[model samples]
Target: MNFLWSLFMRKPALRQFALLDAQGRCQAFKECNQPPVGNGWVEIDEIRLSWMHRPLPARARVSPRPAQSSRHQPLAA
Candidate 1:
């Protein structure tokens, strides 16, 4: 039974990447099974001067805002 359940269950895939805007600020942190593609975005590992507005600082890091929790939702008045 355990083996059958495992076969049916889908495993989650993990991906970590950061997106920077024209000003070099962290616009978003993406996590998906497949690579994300869009305008004004590039992978953190790749280096492309054309995609970046300016050179990033050596100590620069991408720290996007934390995901909001459902518990914080306001009750409808």
Candidate 2:
């Protein structure tokens, strides 16, 4: 019957790929260059496991400020 068919014919969900670590943790695609402990496809909803694992942009290093002069005395108001 049409009703039975509707119940069984649900739309297929989207598939997502993920890399897992040795402890079964999810890793981001950018970090896939490193050796994997475990790897496989994951559901879209499970993407959160790897969300925080994404590689961050490299930050520029800042040099320390020069030492202040010792003779700089503050004037009284």
Candidate 3:
């Protein structure tokens, strides 16, 4: 006998939505905002999202530059 539980089941994945203009540029997100009245626009109803998490192992170290000989030079008017 097999018993199924809701806690062990995976949740349904949701889709993202976006509005694009005539030049294929993103104008609005979540499909909640109203688009312009007279222009060629496209609606993406089922936009999938990809997420990732990556941590860098090490960071680069930068050293300061040495002082130039202009330290003792006088200022000109």
Count clashing residue pairs per candidate: 0, 0, 0
Residues 1-77, candidate 1: write the lDDT tens digits: 99999999999856555576777755566666555787644445433344344544544444544666878776896
How displaced is residue 50 in candidate 3, in Å? 16
The per-residue C-alpha lDDT of model 1 at residue 6 equals 100
RMSD (Cα, Å) for all candidates, in order, is 10.3, 21.0, 23.3
Per-residue CA lDDT of candidate 3, range 1-77, in tens? 13467767776644334444554445544533443354533334443332111211112111323556855776885
Q: Model 3 shows how many backbone clashes? A: 0
Per-residue lDDT of candidate 2, residues 5-70 (tens digit):
989897654434455455544455422222235544232323444254553222211233366678
The prediction achieving the highest lDDT against the true structure is 1
Higher lDDT: candidate 1 or 3? Answer: 1
Error of 1 at 20 (Å): 0.9
Ranking by lDDT: 1, 2, 3
Better of 1 and 2 by TM-score: 1
The parts of candidate 3 lying over 4 Å away from their true place are 1-5, 31-77
- TM-score list, all predictions: 0.39, 0.25, 0.27
In terms of TM-score, how similar is model 1 to the real structure?
0.39
Give the Å error, residue 4, model 3. Answer: 11
Best by TM-score: 1
